[model samples]
Target: MAPPQPKAVAKPAAAPAGGVQKAKLGKPRNYDLGNGVVRFSKTKMFHKKAKYKFVGKKNPKAEKAKKPTVVVKQIGGEKNGGTRTVLLRRRRSFYPTQDKITPRPHHKTFSKHVRRIRPNLTPGTVCILLAGRHAGKRVVLVGVLPSGLLLVTGPFVFNSCPLRRVPQRYVIGTSTSVDLGDFQLPAHLDDGYFKKNKKSAKRTVKRKTGEDIFATKKEKYVPSEQRKADQKLVDEAVIKAIGKRADKKTLRGYLKAAFGLRSSQFPHRLRF
Candidate 1:
């Protein structure tokens, strides 16, 4: 009909002054404003600008500020029932004085009543055996035990004292003391140290000999006879160094005089 009148064409809406067109929903409005709550826009094109900018925004609820504590002080004889005013001060830090600090319950306590008796014998001191099979024998003190006992040795020369422990009371201290100038013996050496060294020396010799025959094979051997022989040699050397050519009777007499023992205390017959 009449060449079909063209339909009127509608023009698109003009954009706003700031070059950003208004949202079809309306101006971006915050439903929750004063409560500090933020709601994101559901539309893909909406991007709301923040009202206030902060370099580093920290949450107030995340870390609570600590309140300062108050301390009270009273002056002018408050405990004596005097009229005194109380003063309040903020306590930043506390440091206790010596009088205010309590002592530890497990602190070590000292007592004058506690007594410790030391042994009369000392190393290099010559002493006479008063009891046991080696009684009336001359022996040199080698070590002192924590139990107040004495370790004596004759070096297997004077009276066959073989590194034995004797009670302090059973042995009499003598005035004749040997000077240990070059001879060094530890004050607290155990009996097993000497025996073990002697055994090791003997075993080392046998190991050297076996190593020559079988270079690849290993052997664990201990020769008891050789150990005894080595120990005897060591004892003899020690004895010769201590007193050369001194007879057993002469040593006994010298020790007896050092101990100031009377003739009645002497043994009736020499056992060995």
Candidate 2:
């Protein structure tokens, strides 16, 4: 039993001393493969992805050499899928025909239902014209716009209602707000200043002189002298803000009265 007393071989493990925690490669560190020569290697071809014990265990041949030959394929293999398409490089239609375009929407879809504006439609508010071509008239609201649209005006020399742009849910707001003291509005009354030219200089001059564009004569809408000098500077600044309002004859008799509804009127019990 005295012959088994010569076995004591436990030595290595003392190489970790440099910064930021990455020092594990402990043993087999020497190589000189000049022509894979027989010198003294010890790494079986360097590191051989070296490991000592649980070097971060797990290996079915390193998980089959780390997978990914481009796969995300689960279209018809549908295991709970709605959109996981990774066609990933199967090349071969190198432009022999269909170059494709016009598909659309990868972006631009705004105006999300935004037509809000009428909290008593402000800016000098008088409002009444409910639906177009001056329905039941009374205009005034002067300018709100940024796409919410109100800008009204009957200041077309009293009641013809010219400086347009309607939709504050088709106007109506009334407890008559007017004052407009220092006036302001005209920075070119925008909404592209009531944008009209939908290309009709008499149907483009009768389509460039070939005439008889439906026997001419219907091109009527003639307002421009810069739209009569911007409706005479917005009707002389709304007659100087209704002549310093002392209810200026009930605001010109509520814009020449005609907004009907008299059978004991009840537009939601009309407060305005």
Candidate 3:
């Protein structure tokens, strides 16, 4: 060999000004998280999984005491006349006990819950009316009615207060009582019996006229035959019952007369 020669090595080409730009290429096997779509992944593609510690709701069983405390209690009752010893497993809870507010009695049950009939008020007792169109009129109590009302009748022939219903609070009960003596009122009578029938609606709507809405009508409301029969039934029984009394005529006169106060006579001072 003549003379040793150095090996030539090729160097990288010089880049242009502002650096050379490379062609963009698509990334393979990569995807973004879907917004609640099918089989979506929470972690971003090629990203490390979050290292946050797992958290969950507290277990109710674990919150309870590990070992219940033994407690002694004394209970007394009619069956167990004396005190009895008992072992109770009392558990101390993590949360303090909270007091709850109680509510008042319900309105639905209030009516039935507070029902009480006056002992003084009884069937067939004579009472004096204190209110209504026939105020100061004396009537006989036929029977106890629904909703603590008194079913009374003025016998129609006397005070014109036909078989009617009045509240127990509106009348004063007298010592006088009527002896039905094997007589009883018809069972058909009830709260519904005293209710007036609703007027029938007109089939055709008539044109408006210049008549007063409350003007006096030519025809008057007449009691039906059934009402008349019921009235007669009640009155006849009452009349017959009165006739058997010792002071029948005096009692009739007292009922027929209207009650009123004289010049300075106090009603409270007078007895019924």
What is candidate 3's lDDT per residue for 89-167, written digit by digit as tens?
3335545478767887866754365546677778777888989998999888888765667889987899899888888
Write candidate 2's Cα lDDT for 1-272 as tens digits. Answer: 45666768988655567634555776543444567665455565345545555566876653346445465555555576554655456567755467667776665345444666757777888878867667998878877767777777777767777878877766678988777777777677777768877754443235666776565344667887887888788778876888788879888877877596888888888887
Which stretch of 10 consecutive residues in model 2 shows the poorest summed lDDT?
199-208
**Alpha-carbon runs more than 4 Å astray in model 1:** 1-120, 186-241, 244-272
Q: Please provide TM-scores, in order, for all candidate models, with all chains considered together.
A: 0.34, 0.28, 0.53
Per-model CA lDDT versus the true structure: 0.58, 0.72, 0.76
What is the lDDT, from 0 to 100, of the residue 34 in candidate 1? Answer: 52
- Among these predictions, the greatest TM-score belongs to 3
Clashing pairs in 3: none
lDDT of 1 at 109: 46
- Candidate 3 deviates by what RMSD? 29.9
Q: Mind giving the per-residue lDDT tens digits that candidate 1 earns over 47-75? A: 34432454378668666786545444444
